[model samples]
Target: MLDQLIENATVVDGTGAPAYAADVGIRDGRIAALVRRAPGAPADRAPDRAPDRAPGDAPRDRARTYVDGTGLVLAPGFVDPHTHYDAQLFWDPYATPSMQHGVTTVAGGNCGFTLAPLHPERPGDADYTRRMMARVEGMSLVALEEGAPWSWHSFGDYLDALEGRTAVNAGFMVGHCALRRYVMGPDAIGGRPGADQLDAMLRLFHEAMEAGAWGLSTTQSGTHADGDGQPVASRHAGPEELLALSRAVGEHQGTQIEAIVAGCLDRFSDDEIDLLVRMSAAAGRPLNWNVLTIDAAVPERVPRQLAPSERARQAGGRVVALTMPILTPMNMSLGTFCALNLIPGWGDVLGLPVPERIARLRDADVRAQLLRRAGSEEAGVFRRLAHFDRYVIGDTYAPANEGLTGRVVRDIAAERGMEPFACLVDICANDDLRTVLWPMPSDNDPASWELRRETWQHEDVLLGGSDAGAHLDRMCGAPYTTRFLGDCLRRRKLVGLEQAVRMLTDDPARLLGLRERGRIAEGWHADLVLFDPERIDAGSAVLVHDLPGDSPRLDSRAEGVVGVWVNGVRTVREDALTGAVPGTVLRSGRDTETVGTR
Candidate 1:
């Protein structure tokens, strides 16, 4: 008898093929059989009209459990290739909100941030790791300190801690920052490692690979900084050092590379382009960067950003770019260290204590300097927030800001007879700089959406970069899969549902070399999602104090997700987790295949 049978559903199959009516059976955590309906048959009649059934097959009534998937779309579970769920999985084993959106598998430890391989003799290394994560990833410091025990010292031990304890299949890459700090200690930042230190790093990288790390993830993005306001460890490494680590990846099976160069947030320089090609070629594996933002207003940005991928291909290597189809809305505050601090010279004034920061903001010279830096060419991606007038006030704490919530800074400034920048500073100052600011993205024009649809079909691009686990308080990108699907179905209609599912599932799975987990073929793992095609979406973001130590985070619930299963165990029902913990801790060479570079 089948363990479970889902009947009368439209199966998209995660292959970009046309959807068809079918009944699927699961047994022993694998797809046991598929009973496909004849062409043009109605889904409700699929079971009775199923064709090509094998002899001695058990009837639908013989299944131990049955799911009525009437009028719903059944597809392979979504795979998120870029996330920071490393610490969240320790306390919230379900990887909440993600599984609620049909994400059955997640790859974490991106952008050179991981939580393992601590220095054997230095106990303070753990504290440094926590603070760094808090600073760069937007994770809550209180949650990081109280969420999980910092007992493990090696990558293997860290992986072991999560084994059999999660509700979603999770894999992680070894981060360059942790690897550097482990070997070079306090000298890990802003210097070339000596010969002996280099050798130690290579050996540690090998050990991590052996212990099931997905691959190597590093960063050279100028924006990343530790709690001490120093550049991240990976930013200090020269190209030779990076290439040496890339060479180490070539020796491992089922390993790839993930990196974030400075060009990831802007246009690529010729040297950065060549360096990416060399790294991919050195590793003999594909290298995928974090994000590729598309805006039709900037017509040259897409081609310029994708030029490196073409260059890498010509050089006998592969480079893929991750792009989000939906614009994830994020909230920022003046009191915290955020992208605002990355605005070139603005960091010096913004990094001061609340009293000093407010005092500086009140100074005319300081405001001019900050404004000038934000509008300059050096701002890069952070320039998007330069339009102080467009920011909508979110939460306010001072009595002087009454009736100002939900108002734009420009309108308020006009009413108060003040410049928009001065008005913004005044509002935040009234709240002691704790006012929440929601800057509206200017790239939501129709042309931009059209360009995004075209770019979604690009050969060198894939759909991901959710950043779900990090930036918990400011943003919640975990629901992009459902949100994009909803837009495609009901709003945008730019991309077909079949193709979108394929982008969210098979594309990233193939790029990451996940083994038999991205499709609904017979004998493949039965990770699946069933949802209403008419109403699926991610709801609005809301702040919730659910993290450890009662820290707050932005969260959203799904609209039409009905059921989700990981490895044949139902983990979510009706947009809520079912407390099932049957997910596998995916490891390189065991749960994946070696996807070659060329």
Candidate 2:
């Protein structure tokens, strides 16, 4: 008997091992036994057929729950290493999109944006945190204006606020933005920290590390901007400040690091790559460069970028470029807050009155500027947003325009003999700036996809970039685990099942230094997911209005994520929450020490 028993599961083991049938026994929030394998057999490994178990080591405690997993595959729950749920956690502790798709762990405090130990008073005391979050996370100012109960600002205090949370386990990283604001104040506005300000900021980073922040994350990219279209605090800092801040990570057990450099479209300039190398050298820790991927529709671009990433890593600069899946759903908008437009100086176009915006779009001069910006590879502007010839899939404000759903704006503009921008603005204004823009890239080509698969298989590249808990409106990358396992591993055979499981499981766990997690050995944390590897498929991306601000998020459901557990407590039962809250704030490296089978 046991507190719980998962019998006959094809255990993927999360160790890059071939799948094999075994019974997983759990009790008191830990893996108690491995249901002994056949005698003279090679431990947990088994051929196509199953292995026999040794004499029963069942506990006197009878199973409180039991499930037959005869036809299902079981693996360690996913550890989503990249996400911006710092703001969302204040409201939705479950971290929806990621957790719903079997993510049992998340890393927040990305891009140096986190709410924490403030020297100031409460919520209103540090409006900067709220404002920065509003700009970076696309969080509605009104929501933070009303929702978050901002009490403290110390890194440890922030953790106290987030501890014992109810969704999946989470880890916190010290953000560069918070550091700048805490010390440099508004001086951080232009990027460079003055001499004294730089020293103070560095000291705070070290203090945060000692207080148990997992690592440091910052962005050097211009894409990260404040509401006024200025670079976020850390984005403008020179290479020296970045390297000093990165050094803080090395002090506390050599913590992990994450960074976002500007320019998603072009390869890093020599100076940028040199900067990354210096930061890595200073920190003496591995760094996860924000992202590394090309437009899936055009396969050549990724190779161009990956070449530099590989060069950096090979140069003893431990850096890994997280690659997004082929279908990085495009969400375009002409709203006042469309963050993408900030790049080409077109951000001004968004905040204008609807009539003014429409007039400008139709202006010959404005159209020329937009055209020039759209055609430049350096801009990385998704042309689909400016090209109004797209059709509306759905809308609430205007019924007459709602029928335009599924029709391309190009076709409509051609029929009416109107310019793309004119048609776009008319529809937008007519619909109260509520139009869903979808960029359906040519289906990920099999040959190209296979090449991408090779990247996932690399010892360095972990499978991720779901961008869950952020970008609520534009993309829904949260449920990518199922697709990686189902479509890429099982369906296409691009990577072996064992290798795929390792990518989603062990690799990230190791990278994040969660010692007791992402492995299925006896006495490890019993965090697990059970599914049908053969039948696993990602559901179609659909818009769902679930955020506190009626902010819609693209949610792609998993077809076969049947059950998930955290610390042996069932969190997702039959693909829905059991209403049980067993998660906690896991400070990496520290978590294994604080809460282990010892």
Residue ranges of candidate 2 with Cα displaced over 4 Å: 36-62, 121-125, 296-300, 307-315, 381-392, 417-422, 489-493, 549-551, 592-598
* Ten-residue stretch with the least lDDT total in model 2: 43-52
Candidate 2 per-residue lDDT, tens place, 1-598, comes to 4677776678889898777777788988888877633433332222332223322333334455666676788888889888877767777777776776788888888766777546563344378777767777767676676656676678888887877765688888888877887776677787577788888887787778777788888887777777555778788788778877777676677377788887443567667777776676677777776566644565665665565456656565566677765466666666546644754757667668877876776678887787677656646635434444443444436866856877777777888898766676667767667676654454457766766866665655667777787777667778878777776655667777787778888888887778689988889999899987777767877878776667666777777888989888888865677766788888655673211100
Candidate 1 regions exceeding 4 Å error are: 39-61
Tens-place lDDT per residue, model 1, 274-335, is 98999998898999997998887668878988988898888878999999889998888889
Please state the error at residue 511 of candidate 1 in Å.
Answer: 0.4
RMSD of 1: 2.7
